[model samples]
Target: MTQKSSVRQMIGFITDVTRWSLSGGIGYQLFLCLLVVFMMLGVFAYLVQWKLGLAVTHMSDIVSWGFYIANFTFLVGVAAAAVMLILPSYIFKDKDFHHVVIIGEVVAIGALVMSMTFVFVDLGRPLQGWHIIPIIGLFNWPSSLLTWDILVLNVYLVLNLSIPAYILYCHYNQVEPDPRKYRPFVFISIFWAFGIHLITAFLYEGLPARPFWNNPLMGPRFLASAFAAGPALITVLLVIIHNTTVFKIPKQTFNKLRLIIVISAIINLIMLFSEVFKEFYFPTHHSLSAEYLYFGLDGHNSLVPWIWTAISINIIGTLLLAFNPGKNKPMLLLPACILLFVGIWIEKGIGLIVPGLVPSPLGEVVSYAPSWVEISIALGILALGMFVVTMLLKPALIIEHRFKAEKPS
Candidate 1:
């Protein structure tokens, strides 16, 4: 193609993306408006945080890490969940996942972007964020796991964006992408996905002072919960797609996802049990964190209800999903999946981070609750992520549907 033709094609691609992204129903419009409102609120709150300092939130010296890092940690896992689909669809050539693999990749992009945002927000010196740049700044790359996290996350973000952009651009132009061009990225992404979450796990486990997070099982637990929650969220999105659009996801796909959720949930629950037994039965100094998380330590039981709620939801969701009856019913399946996702969210969110900080390694029991500002900011970040997911998936579904309709019988 000549330069002029290439430019025209690029313009056309831009037009297509904008057209599809902006086109939706009244409901979609209202949803977008709502997201905009939340984004505005969050931005305003973040500005306040920026001006007044981190004190606007509920974090303290004892609980230096709060909602932001928790979200960053969980979202990194959600981002990694794309690998589950990529590996099977690409390496094993499972055609069932071929179309939806793009969906997972797009979701990864949104999650990763949100994860990066959370990290930025968590930084006390957000303006000096560039200081982490190699050579130009004082980054402890080889000596610091955080530097490894920074590298892997950004690289993973690039891979997720480029792979989909290439594939989706091919679809937009009604062409097939060359496997050799994108396949190696797929393989690298699979391992890179694992590395992102593992590095995060290491960040937590490396902190020997936080006995709650010092467990050797932390890495496996992160992966298990991630695989369960990530696919569960995708399954929920697939159901939404089926209900709203002409595109159809195979029931078999949901069934396969159901199995993944079930197995991963069981493993996660088993890990939970192992932690419980070790903490409650042996009753060591490390057990204080567990006791505080579940039953409260010294009249400070704010997280008790939250932890139990998470546990109950996980159990109910696991049983419902594992059984034949619930798996077959969309009504049951949808709610079960939601429960599983929210359950893991809570488990990993406050349930994972807060307890470790409570009764700090020095036996300081400082309770932390997210102020309205923190909550608003979190809601905003979540809305931002949803908006990204919505916009990215819109053009993808449009192109996929066009291809599907154009295919010869």
Candidate 2:
């Protein structure tokens, strides 16, 4: 291997120390092992998806978009949330957020990886994954939103990963980061993060047949939900990192998290309400989708009940996190996190996919039931995400710890 490649691998190998610890530890090792086993299983199932076709999953002509697309979109939302920390720190000169910008970028990287992985799994003709390459392949450069998503997500990923990795390298090497050296790239990160999620939302909103997805507000709603879910995810991740190691987050960091959570949560909740009102006020055949969401337009339903519960849980969670920031005690924070995740997952995953399938534009009603294999595969992807986060962030955290000790904190 080239010397540069060797050095990168060595850095990665050092990062694997946490994997080694997780493999050896008594309590947490269980999760580590499970993450591995699940990932392997997921990979096997993906092979099945590739070998067979999309048939292994429950997708149909009516339900062209299923869990994978949903996962992709949700991950974009998760990835975009990192801007809460990254932009405010770099652009606004918030030194407090500077402390965790690396962490935030790493989280964005993790989410981006999962989002792209979902793209690989979602394609019907898996081998056609390469068709989008420009000079070497048949490029759908103009028409498809999938194409745009592919471009934006990947570009954003490189920018996000580069910024953090470069910063961390400076941290590890005990060298000053030439602020001038990275400023242009940092400016790009601010726009790239927004672009990634906006393109994802546009991918759906641009679709005309899917009235459920055809709202102008869909894009902003996505950003709002992303803002909420992303920060909440980061907060949980911060707490997890704190609890899992000797590291501790001070009150100041927690305060920033609380503020971001509140602002984002309020925006997200308001967006949901506006969505409901937009449907009710105009009351078109299009209104049926929102009706489907809130009050079950027809006898056709397994989602409305759970969706109502999800909305309730989401609203309550948002209220608790946003309004009662004082009660960020672990118990409150934990449930609030669970509720926000579930709510957004349902809204984006089930809510988006299922309703679009229902009372179809052609007036067909079809439902998707993912098989054991498919469900396993999806769980495996999530496990893979968790495993990757553990592997990538652990060594970085250790390095950060050493940096904090050596530098004037």
Candidate 3:
């Protein structure tokens, strides 16, 4: 294709995506409306915060990071989890996985967007975010993990969006995608996926003052939980897609994804156990954060109940997956996946972020709870992500269906 023709084709592709997003059934439209309402509320709340300042939220010098950073941490893992699907489909050449890989890419794009948004909102002055940009801002490079994180995340987002767009454009044109053109990007994304999450983990582990996040296993634990939670989410989404739309997913695909989820969940649980044992058995000054999380520190035990509940739910979910009691039944499988996803969200979000800063380095204890403003903004960001995913998926599904129909039998 000539350069001019390629540009024209890309414009047509975007036009189709917009049309499909806006033209859906009553249920889909209602869902979109609900998301829009929340988005509006979030925008209102953000504006209030912007005018009033971070003081409107509960974060203080004692607990510098709060609700926003927690979500950012979890979403980064979710974004990285796309590699689970991509690696298997491309490197291993799993044909069944190839059909669904684009779906994973769409999810990654939504997640990365959310992750970046959270980072933006966490800033007291959102406008200062320009400083993080490479040329326009003073992005401290090489030495700064935040700069590294910003680099990897933006690159991964572009890769995910472009690769899927290339394939879908080819399908729209009723032509085969050139592997030579896109395959290199695919391989780069697999490694870049790991880099984004690992760098995010480094952001925590690099902090020596916060012993709770300083473990060497932090990166591996992040990866394990991400692989488990990410696929669990995708599994639930696949079921919804199969039921609601004309597209059909293969049974083997579910089986393969389930296997990946189970293995990763087990590893995540084992790592959790190891970390707990190390913290409780030795009982050093460094273990204070863990103690604050699980028990109470100086009678301030806000996180105790949440952590235990997350652990219990995670155990139940993992067992449910291991036993296979439902025998591939959606009734059983869906709940298990939901449980795993929610449990990990809690474990990684509040369970991880809050404790690291609970008992301040100076031995002061400060409790943190998100204000209504923070909650509203987070809901808005999450709704926006769902909205994006829903819109993107419509055009992707249409293209996939058409491609399958036109393929030579």
As for candidate 2, its clashing pairs are: none
Q: Scored by CA lDDT, what does every candidate get?
A: 0.90, 0.78, 0.92
lDDT of 3 by residue, 1-409 (tens): 7999989988888898789878989998999999999999999999999999999999999889999999999999999998989999988999878879888888999999999999998987777777778889787998999899989999999999999988998999899999999999999999999999999999999998899999999999999999999999999999999899999999888888889999999999999999999999989999999999999788888888888888998999989988889986889999999999999999999889998997888889978889999999999999999988998998899989989999997
Q: What lDDT tens digits, residue by residue, belong to model 2 across residues 1-409? A: 5999869966764565545435545667777877889888998998887788888888788777777877888999999888889888888988778777777888888888887888777777767767678888877877988788888888888888777667767767666688997889998878888888888888878989888888788888888888878888888888887788866766577677877877877887888888887789879887776677667755766677778887888888887877666566776786787788788878877787667766777877654667766777887888877776776676677667777889874
Any residue pairs clashing in model 1, and if so which?
Answer: none
User: What is the C-alpha lDDT profile of model 1 across 1-409, one tens digit per residue?
Assistant: 7999889998999898998998889999999999999999999999999899999999999889998988998999999998888988999998888768888998899999899988888899977987999988889978888998999999999999999898888878878789999999889999999999999899888888888998899999999999999999999999999888888999888888888889999999999899898899879888888899999889888889988999999999999999858645678899998998899998998899999888886798867778888888888999999999999999989988887777675
Among all windows of ten consecutive residues in candidate 3, which has the lowest summed lDDT? 124-133
Give per-model TM-scores.
0.98, 0.92, 0.98
Count: clashes, candidate 3: 0
Q: Candidate 2 lDDT (Cα, whole model)?
A: 0.78
- Model 1 residue 288 lDDT? 88
Q: Which scores higher on TM-score, 1 or 2?
A: 1
